[model samples]
Target: MIITFITAPILGRLLHPSDFGLIATSAPIIGFVTMIQNLGLTQAIIQRRTITKGQTNTLFWLSLLLSLTFATGLFVLAPSLARYFQEPRLIAVIWVGAALTVVSVIGEQPMALLTRNLRFRLLAVIDIIGIIVGAALGVAIAWYTRSYWALLVPLACTRFLNLIVAAFAARWFPGRPVWDEAARQMIGFGAGLSMFNILNFLARSADNLMIAKAHGSVALGFYDRAYRLMLLPLTQATWPLSRIMTPILSRLQGDPEEYRITYISSVSLLMLAVQPGLLCAVIYSDATVALLLGSKWAEAAPMFACLGFAGLHQTFTSTTGWLFISQGRMRDLSIVGLVSSTSTIASFAVGLPWGPLGVAVSYVISDYALRLPFIWYMTGRAGYVGVGDIYRTVGPHACGLLMSASALVLIKASLHAPSLIELGGILAVTYAINSAILIMFRSKRRLILQVLKVACRSVMLHRTSRKGRF
Candidate 1:
């Protein structure tokens, strides 16, 4: 996340909006194909309690074959995709995306092995290295080439490096493919997850596709950047948590009460971590755009603010996948995905005629009016956690966000054309208000204290261990 913050502004300055727009146009198509490339076998590997050598080998070969097929298909379809988007630049981008797709799957099983074993620290190290190097390369490419290749090439490099590193770390290799019973079961499990993933991608990417088609690349660029910014909380915070929790929750699946308690606490903690920052984004959108992406991106501020509001709900909604995958409830997840994709695509259509800003605004409205309620209902309907549990967990934090947003709005209103310093101060005030509100709730206070205690104890233990070693 820090790396992202540091690089985005530099890239914003170095690259044109159309460069980003070109990449954005190809991203949905690449992302959708990438989803199919995995066939959800990684999640299946993570979710399953037991796996044999033969099963792993079988899945590995199957994954390789699927990836090659899709990569070739994407390479072949590049011109068609470019024609569809009416952007000739996209052909090269799609070809690069194809290579990236192949590179990414080369070590899927290794990465999934690490994940299944709960080696998150190792995974984090690999990912951080990949992202940092990628960002650096991207900046250099942007400085030189000053084109969309900067964005595309770095990602492929990162994936290639990640695979190499992960393969070395995992110390596992695939043998001859075998279609054993266990492999078949894993495939069956993955099939359901793949369906859900495809649908979910459509729901998420429909807006980008529609925006690019109707409003053009420059408009799509602004919307895409704002959308990516809005998604930072999910990408940085919730995603990592989901990775860690999926295995833990899968282990705890037999204990209903424990699963419910664990999930609720996780959700509460996530809301506490992200909601205040999102609120700050909403209240200070223009300043944030100036600070992060420069004044040239002033056009994205309203869109950013609108999407920032939507992100609050999305933070929690993103976690629904954790519950579904952990519980082996992919069918239920698929149903929810289908519903969400339909509504979200329809919402995009309704907003398209009005341009990207209208699409952004409509997204916020639809998330609150349609998507959020349905997601919460479906996710909680049959799990150890229910609808009421979901509400109670997020409700207080939502209230706190609302209050903080109100206070920040009033505070901003009182200040006339606040500088970057004032924006910083406003963010500080927002955090203070949220912290105070959070402490007012007994459960939240307890959770906070418990977390602090754990953190302190870990620090002390580390120091003591270092002293002993010395």
Candidate 2:
């Protein structure tokens, strides 16, 4: 993650916005195809309470077959998609992405097995190593080659390396295929989840697709960067929690009260982890874009801020997956996904004429207006958790978000400080105010302090272990 944060600006400055835009434009096809390819069967592997070796093997073979089929479709469709986007160069990009998908699905079962067995340390190492190496490789290639292939090649290599590493780390192998009633059940679960993911992929990629088509690649480049900037909290914090939470939540499913309590508590900690960052991004959107992607992306500033506002809503709503998947409520999740996707696509259409900033603003409005309420209501209906529980979990962070936003605004307007100094002052005030408010919340305060202590002890133990080894 640190490597990615550091390298994004360097790549942004080195590569054209068109380059990123091209990637963004071509991404939806891959996203949609991959969702189909997986059939969400892999997640079913993790979600199910018990699975026979035969069921696992059957799913594995099914996954491999679908992956091959989709890779071929992508490779064949590359030219037409490129023509549609009016970026002929996208042909190669799509082709490379096709190969990458084949490599990616190869790891699905092993990785899923690792998740099922709770081998998170190995998963963490696999993820960190794959991304760091991939980012470094992408930066180096882009520096020298100045080509979009730089991005594509590194991505392929990353997945390739991840497959190799995960295979070894997981130490699990699939045997002969066995299709049975259990396989049918697993596929049914996976197909439902796949439906949800298909909607999710459309929601995620529709904005980028429309921006690229209507406004062209340059506009897409800015919007894409802005959107990614907004999603940093989701990627860095909330998404990871969803992974850890789903499996843990699945375990707690039999105990409704415990599951409810745990879900609420986890969401609280997730907000604690991500809310301040979202606040900072919303407050410092321009500075952040300037600092991270360089001044060349100044067009993305307004869009970034708008998207940052959406991030607050996203921080809470993205966690709905935990409740849905853990509770085996994929049908409900799929319905929510349909509504969310429809709302997002409509926002893109409404916002298209005004450009990326308009799209960004519309996204925030749609999220809060449509997606948030839908998710809150749907998850409540699906699980033991309810709307009041969500309010109790998220309300404090929502207040803290408002407080942080106000502090930053006051610092900018009243103090009239310079950019760097003003940002520092805003951050300090936001931190102080939010910290005070959190300390007043005894439960949240305890969780924060507990996490800090665990981190400190882990560091101390590492140091002592090193000394003893010496």
Candidate 3:
């Protein structure tokens, strides 16, 4: 998140909106191809209770073959995609994305092995290194070339580096392809997940495609940045939790009571951590855009604010996947994806006539009105956790969100066109208000304290371990 905030401003200054748009235009297709490259086997690797060496080797070889095939296909289709988008520059970008697809799969099984074993600390270190190096290189390239290669090259480099580090860390390698019942079953499971992923990607990326086609690259760039900004909190809060919890929850699948308690509490804690900040961003979207991406990006503020409403719920909504994947309910997950993708696409179409802001507004409406409820219903339908459980967990935080928004509104009204410093102060005040409100609730206060205690203990343990190592 810090890297994002730092690099966004630098990149925004060095590159044009069209530069971002061109890349964003290719993102949906690139992302979709990347999903095909995975074929969901990684999730299967993580979710399966037991796996044989033969099965892992088979999956690895299959993944490699698929990655190569798709990469070649993408490389071949680059010019066609550029023609479709009517932007010849996109051809090279798509080719780079195709190469990234191949590099990404080289360490897939190793990374999945790390995830399954709950080696998140090492994973975090690897990610930090990859991101820092990638960000620095991207900035340097952007400064020198002012081209979209900065974006594409750094991403490819990061994936390459991460895979190399992951392979070394895991110390596991595939032998040769083997076909057996275990491999077949895992493939079946992965098929469902892959379907869900395809639909989900389509839903997520449709907006970018439509905006780019309808309004052109410049408009798409603004919308893309706003969408990314809205996702910042979710990426920081929900992503790590999902990664940590998925394997843990998968282990707890047999113990429904524990799974229910664990998932609900973690989600509650996540909402408590992220909700207030999202509210502040919604209230001060302009300031956030100015601070993070420069004043030149002021055009994206309304879009960002509109998307922030959806993001408030999106943080929790994204975690629903953990429930699906961990519980091995891939079919139900696919059904949910089908519904979500259909509605999300419809929403995009409904709003495209009004441009990007309209799309943002429509997405929020569809999310709250259709997608969120459906996903909650489906996830709770047969699980230890139910819809009522979700409502109860998020209810108080939702109330707190309203209160925080109200407080920020009052604060904003009293201030006149506050500067960046004032915006920082407002954020502080918002968090303080949220903390006070949360403390007023006994249950939430207890959870907060419990989390703090665990955090402190982990820190102390880390320090002690470091001293012993030295």
Candidate 4:
């Protein structure tokens, strides 16, 4: 995951943002289909108290049945659906993607075992290996062919590899499917999560479709790149947090109060550090885009600036959805989906006329303005996480970000940056200075000091460990 995160800049430098945009356009349709394949069985396994081998086999067979059904439907509809998007070549692409159905059938039980055991280190390693291989393939193919298909197929192929490896890695072998009673208990949970995933795709994909329809694929490409960049910070925080905190949250599950406290603390720490990193990226949007992507994606710089504010909004609310899931308050999650999708669809309806730029603006408003309030309510009422809890965690970071933003703008404007290298340095320095001032003035002097102490300790420990024998 870390390597993939770091490799993005290299990718941005190599491929056209439009290439990414084109592939992103496929995601909604593909994900919509994938949602159907799961039928909630996988998630049901995770959230269940116990999943027997026989029941797991039943779920696996059911998943395989769904996969073949969906694949057949996909193959038959592929050309028409491609034409619907006005990219008829997509039919062949979708045909190839349909193979995942067969490949993933063997994966459900082993994957469930891994999840049941909470062995995410193996999971992460598998993820990283797949990405490393896929990214290498993507870069090589893009550099050689410069075709959008290169990006599209590599994504599907990597998942196929992961399913194959992870299936065997967990040492679970497949057997005949048998109907089981335990499987029935999991149906509702799976259905709800599947529905949520579908709508979530629509909410996100609506923006891409609108942008593509109004602004064209070239512009949507730039918009997609910006959105991807915006998400890097979330990925950074969530990837690790999901691994570490979920177990902790699971242990504290019997006590809502403790779970709530730990949840809020985890979110707070994630937001506090990620805010400045994203702020720097936003401030240096032009430089960063230019440095990584060169002149070809100059349009993406403004797009990055446009979508960057979404990062701040996400910092507070991203994990709230998980909170709703953890406590079985999925009604809140459904509400979140309903409201966010409605807001985004409505915003896209109103904003598409203005093209990609308008889409970016509406995204920020719909996400922060409409969706956040509901998330706040959900987390507060269901998770028992208080309003003050959020205020305490996010308030200082918000202030620091605001300060950093102001300094960044001034520094960028003042320097008349001629290169990405210069702009990155200026943004980093200004953000640090601004953050320092904010930290000193904020009443959370104790928290600030604690972070400093940890930083110093980490450095000393690293040095000491290096100097001593392994």
Cα-based TM-score, every candidate:
0.97, 0.95, 0.96, 0.88
Whole-structure CA lDDT of model 2: 0.82
The digit string of per-residue lDDT tens for model 4 on 166-277 reads 7888877767665756667677677777777667778888888777666666788888877877887788678657755544565567897888767865775676667777
As for model 2, its CA RMSD to the true structure in angstroms is 2.0
Clashing pairs for predicted structure model 3, backbone only = none
All-Cα superposition RMSD per candidate: 1.3, 2.0, 1.7, 3.1
lDDT of 3 by residue, 1-470 (tens): 88878998999999999999998999998889889888899999899999877888899989899999998999999998898889999888888888888888888889999999999999899878888988999999999999888877667777898789999899888796779888898999899999999999999999999999899999999999999999988898887788799899999988999999899889888887788888888888888888888888999999999999998897788898998888889889999989999999999999999999999989889899988889989988987889888887777787777788888888888885778788878888887887777777777888889989999999999999999999
Better of 3 and 4 by lDDT: 3
Q: Which candidate leads in lDDT? A: 3
Best by TM-score: 1
Q: Candidate 1 lDDT, tens digit per residue, 1-470?
A: 89889989989988889888888888988898888888899999999999877788888888889989998999899999889889988888888888888888887889999999999999998888888888888889889888777887667767887788888898888787778788898998999999999998998898989888888999999998888888876789987898899999998988999998898889888888888888887778888888889888999999999988888888888898999999988889989889888888888888889999999887789889988988888988997888898877887787788789889878878885688787878888888898888888888889989989999999999999999999
Could you arrange the candidates by TM-score from highest to lowest?
Answer: 1, 3, 2, 4
Model 1 spans with C-alpha error above 4 angstroms? none
Question: Arrange candidates by lDDT, highest first: which order?
Answer: 3, 1, 2, 4
Whole-model lDDT, model 3: 0.88
lDDT of 2 by residue, 9-85 (tens): 99889999999998888788876776688899888999988887778888888888998999998888888888888
C-alpha lDDT (0 to 100) for residue 314 of candidate 2: 75
Which residue runs does candidate 2 get wrong by more than 4 Å? Answer: 414-425, 452-470
